[model samples]
Target: MYKIVEKEHFSENVVKLIVEAPMIAQSRRPGHFVIVRIGEGGERIPLTISAADTVKGTITLVVQAIGESTRKICALEIGDCFTDIVGPLGQATHIENVGTVVCCGGGVGVAPLLPIIKAMKEAGNRVVSILAARTSDLIILEKEVSEYSDEVIIMTDDGSKGQKGLVTAGVESVINREKVDLVVAIGPAVMMKFVSLTTKKYDIPTMVSLNTIMVDGTGMCGACRVTVDGKTKFVCIDGPEFDAHKVDFDEMIMRLRAYN
Candidate 1:
């Protein structure tokens, strides 16, 4: 059983958990994820590894309670133990000194982008991050994330905080004003798709993380298949990260809505 060592609410619907998983903590890299089940009969859910402490034997997961399983996971307390936990899955983000890197995150996407931005900064890249939400109350990790970023831009759709605009505006501004070596984007499908569209025009190399319906997380179920560059790829094994220029966003949106 995997125990929850800590839990903090990021928002009304988002919760952060520090889970006790020594093996995963020791070896996990940014962009990897974990699959967890609350009990013997609970549904499996995939969560991104936002941070890991190898020495402390813990890994952090930021979960947004958008559905029944996620809601259950969010409601779990500090001492609760999950019946099953599978870990450190998916390809890790390649960290390198890529000159100027821009990390764009929308809402809960900020959680997953935290580690990536930190790693990029540590690798000697100038990290500029964009955090977006509907309002100030929904924005998370802004303070913590800013420490790892050379510059941070905050955007809100309702003008309740920071600049009043979509995250795309910030992304476009940076691409136009600066020499960006790499752009990393993670968020809702629509947001990522639009970001991809915006960057494609500038010929900027952009990467996006995909959160498809995953089962077994090992590529055995074929549930996470996504078309990249017109070829089939599994998000579990091939990548949760892909070149934005090659991804078929429309197909991904349709697949995600299959049962909805």
Candidate 2:
């Protein structure tokens, strides 16, 4: 069992939990994720590792309680333990010195992008991060993300904090002013689709993390299959990250909206 050592409410519906999993913490890379189950008969869910403290043997998970499984996980207290905590799974982000890179994150997507941005910074790239949410209250990890970013731009749809626009607007500002080496975006499917569309116009290399529906997470279920460059790719193994320009957004959108 993975023990929950600490928990904090980042927002009304978002919770951050630290789990005592030394092995996973030490093994986890910037973009790796884990499959967790709250208890017996519970559904397996995949979440990105927001941060890891190797020395402390803990991994941080920032989760938005959006559905049944997620809500149950969010309801867990500091002392609660998970029935299953499997991985440092999937491939890690490819970090390299890509000159000026922009890491665009929206809402809970900020949690996953945080570590990637830090890794990019350490790779000797000048990192500009754009974090956004519907309102100020929905934003998370503002202070932590700022530490790693060369410049951090925050956007809120309601304009309660930072600029009054979408994260794509921030990307536009950066793209217009400077030569962007790459753009990595993670957020709602619709938001990622738009971010990819926006970056495509500038011809900058762009990647996006897809949060498709999954069950086994081991690539055996084929539930999270997505089309990239016209070929079927399983998000679990092939990538949660893929070339944004080549991904079939229309197909992905149809699949994502089927039951919703």
Candidate 3:
């Protein structure tokens, strides 16, 4: 059993939990994720490892209570223990000293982008980050993200906090004013799709993290298969990260809406 060591509210429905998982913490990287089960017979849910502390033997999970499994997990208190915690799963982001990287995040997607931003900075890249949400209250990791980014841009759909617009607008402004060497985005599939469309116009090198449906994170389950460049790839094993230009966004959107 993995004990919950800490919990912090990110929003009314979103919470961050730090769980005691030494081995995973020691090995998890920028893009690795964890599969968590709250108790016996509980459904397994995948969560990105937002942060890790090897010395403390803990991994940070930013969970949004959107579904039954996640709701159960987020309901857990500090002293509670999980039945299972599996992973350091998925390929780690390849960090390079790429000149200027514009990292984009929408809503809870910002949490997953945290480690990547820090890694980019450590690799000596100037990061211009964009954090977008429907309203100011939904934005995550503003102060923490700012610490690692060279420049941080905030946008809200209703002008509740930062600029009044979508993340794509912010991306356009950055690309127009500066030469962005790399662009990385993570968000709802629709949001990422639009961001990719924007970057495609400028022919920028863009990568996106695909939060596809998954049953087993080990590639045994084919639930996370996606078509990229007309070829099938499994997100669990092949990537949660992929070249944005090549992904078939329409098919992915349809698949995501299958149950909805």
Ranked candidates (TM-score, high to low): 3, 2, 1
Candidate 1 structure quality by residue, lDDT tens digits, 182-240 = 99999998899999999999899999999899988999999999999999999989989
Error of 3 at 83 (Å): 0.8
* Ranking of candidates on lDDT, top first: 3, 2, 1
| Model 3 poorest ten-residue lDDT run | 38-47
Better of 1 and 3 by lDDT: 3
* TM value for model 2: 0.98
Tens digits of per-residue lDDT, candidate 2, 15-45, equal 9999999999988998899989987899999
The ten-residue window of minimal lDDT in model 1 covers: 38-47
The better candidate by TM-score, 1 or 3, is 3
Q: Over the stretch 1-260, how does candidate 3's per-residue lDDT look in tens digits? A: 89999999988999999999999999999999988897688888878999999999999999999988888888999899999999989999999998999999999999899999999999999999999999999999899999999999999999999899999999999999999999999999999999999999999999999999988998897999999999999998888999999999989999989957
